[model samples]
Target: MQAQPEKKHSSTCDSKEDSNKLESRYQFCGNALRITRDFSNNLGISAIIWESGLVLCRYFEQEKISFSGKKVIELGSGTGIVGILAILLGGDVTLTDQPVVLNQIEFNVTSNIPVSIIQRSKVSDLRWGKNEDQFPTDYDFILGSDIVYSPHDFPSLIKTLQHLSNQNTIIYISSKMRETMGAIDFHEKLLPQHFNSELVHRNEEKEINVYKVTKKAREQPSA
Candidate 1:
């Protein structure tokens, strides 16, 4: 789906008026992930690291989910934190976002992932449903964090999700539940109609939900 050009997300970003380079470090899987947020550009929401991404990483660690040798792809990979972590966990990960944010994400990936393990990760530009055909649907895992804030982008987002997943593909979508952002409706109402969605974890303190999703079986035609 084609989302509006990256613009400022006042409600979600830290309360910093002036645009500048902000660096943050995180520890996961025995690696320190160094991410840089460049607010000087029009990358908007994607420039900053969201809490949903951190929560998802935590879920992976807590559940002991092994991405070893799995083909994984992350959508709307802001700052590329989650995708980078997946790589650290032994997954071959592709990080996708708008063209504007690709450079920053690539930087983060290279900064965090060691040169030996870095080969497992790459960055791409994905306009949701518009160019989903460019990607193969054989991924073992599809990852996303805070990608569902706009209702206008829901149709394309859903279409993209469907295109990238097959019967066995597992999707992990971590989102901050904001009533204004329609996170509840997307997770509770819309996603169920398209896939078998499960609420694997809910962080009440952060108001975030991590859903484990898989494709719905095709209905058989009855005579």
Candidate 2:
């Protein structure tokens, strides 16, 4: 959760490094701006989103951001483009991911957003289910894009939800079900933990699905 600046990844031209990048991510609107690469760490990545994310852009423009004054945290913020837009719409937002991706996040946010919106965005590194004390307490909403996939990380991912939650926090997850059994299972196991699960949108071309999750409390919160 700490926002310490780490080593800056060389954005130089090295084909070898490019080959190691697990995949390239793009905006949902067919924008070739943001590209993602999983570095050596399976739990971490570096993102290259220029101009903002298309998926995020659509989401904001479709609906006026409801989280106007609420604190919002975007997990695995590859390029942090979504969180930046959230800030534009009036949410107090934090964009988080590994240090590897923070640099690129900086590039995109600074380039696309106006100075006012940029001021509301905070960038930090958060390794889910691990060191998370650096994160803000009790986020009103949690968001992630294309994060779930590995079964091994399922337990940790699930646990991380509780870590960032308060008595009432909404979780929004968007992912493309690209033929992964592990990712499917993760969703199934995760369904029961929430108070409600509903499909928000589906992108046929990308095979992406978005869900809105409400947390259920078994008992009342302590005053």
Candidate 3:
């Protein structure tokens, strides 16, 4: 993903995590689903979109879930596949990232989605706590992938989470746990703030975890 810089004092809370390099490949899934290389993160993560995102789409198609007709937001949407999936399902979506990565995210979403899936979704640049003033206070849902890595980003991330969410909203996140002590512990402490959080799905063989969050309260941290 492309990146935008953070000016000084904007994020005294930013923390650096270990960096790893990843290669590229595009994999095909069932009809209406496809996987492709995301150059963002320098290709560090696979950014798989099928099951995680397709499940969301299928439920809505089956009328088992309601996203197509609601406002949605996704944070750290690397390739922005999930947010676009919601858009296909009929939700108004805000696709957010650090300004640098927004372009890459937009590239993937625009290229893969069908023109028939008409919906409103934006590539909004968001650097947690740095531009707090620009944050929106209301959204129906928030989604993400592999966002719980850097502790430095956690506080600000949580701050953004609380800011965008309201009583009736849901916050969804999915990530494959990496072999890092700090990364594993982030979910431990961060889990408590969310009113309800449960592991909805996972791939134990791949070390991935998907959690659904709802029932948030407003507790503005000085992030």
Candidate 4:
């Protein structure tokens, strides 16, 4: 995780949260999490809870995915629920999105995580490909939920994934199969071109697919 900035504002509310605020609650790891949603921001989409994120959390529990003692990072963390769950499971987790969403994520993280475990959670701004190099590439696990909805961001997203991963980093991406927005195409076509991807779990009822990805082995040149 990148070093936390010193002058970060402690935001109690924005005009968006002031008027259109809502709480989306969930039970995980025997505790309830209340994620705040704001619908008025320009990036309002990230302020709301998405079903893909919930499905991903369920997948982790059902598969007994272990994040304990691992260095983990989550990209496009909207309400920060997935990364928060990872922290609860003992991962040193960094939750990231555009800068505008950091306050919302920070608010949820502080509210849900107990003081003892909250130190393991960090909130940062990661604009996909632009400044990924500022972060380390040796994370044990990388997570993304509902991040592949737009075809426009695919190249940058793939580049960012490549930049942040090493040979052993395990990447988990959970997305709703939104054919209209090219989410399905990203998994079925673009992602495999860079990583060895496996469809580890699918929730047909929710139309969510969780892919387990690892760096593709580089070919050995002929001697």
Best-performing candidate as measured by TM-score: 1
Give a tens-digit lDDT track for model 2, residues 128-179.
8886766755899898777776667767767777678766888877765655
Record all residue pairs in model 3 with backbone atoms less than 3 Å apart, i.e. clashing: 1-40, 1-41, 2-100, 2-101, 3-100, 4-100, 68-89, 68-90
Order the candidates by TM-score, highest first — what do you get? 1, 4, 2, 3
Ranking by lDDT: 1, 4, 2, 3
Best by lDDT: 1
Reference-based lDDT, residue 3, model 3: 16
lDDT against true structure, model 3:
0.60
- Give the winner by lDDT: 2 or 4: 4
Model 3, position 156, has a per-residue lDDT of 86
TM-score of each: 0.90, 0.71, 0.69, 0.89
Which residue segments of model 3 deviate by more than 4 Å? 1-64, 116-119, 179-181, 217-223
Tens-digit lDDT track for model 1 on 1-223? 1211212221222333434778776676566667788777778888878889988887877666889999999999989989988998999999999999998898788788789788899899999979999999999999999998999999999999999999999999989999898988998899999999887887777788888999999999998
Clashing pairs in 2: none
**Residues 43-153, candidate 3, lDDT per residue (tens digit)?**
344343434443333323333355766888887776676676677666788888776667666766676566666447677888777775586767788887777778778
- Weakest 10 consecutive residues of candidate 1 by summed lDDT: 1-10
Candidate 1 overall lDDT versus native = 0.85
lDDT of 4 at 25: 66
Indicate the worst ten consecutive residues by lDDT in candidate 4.
2-11
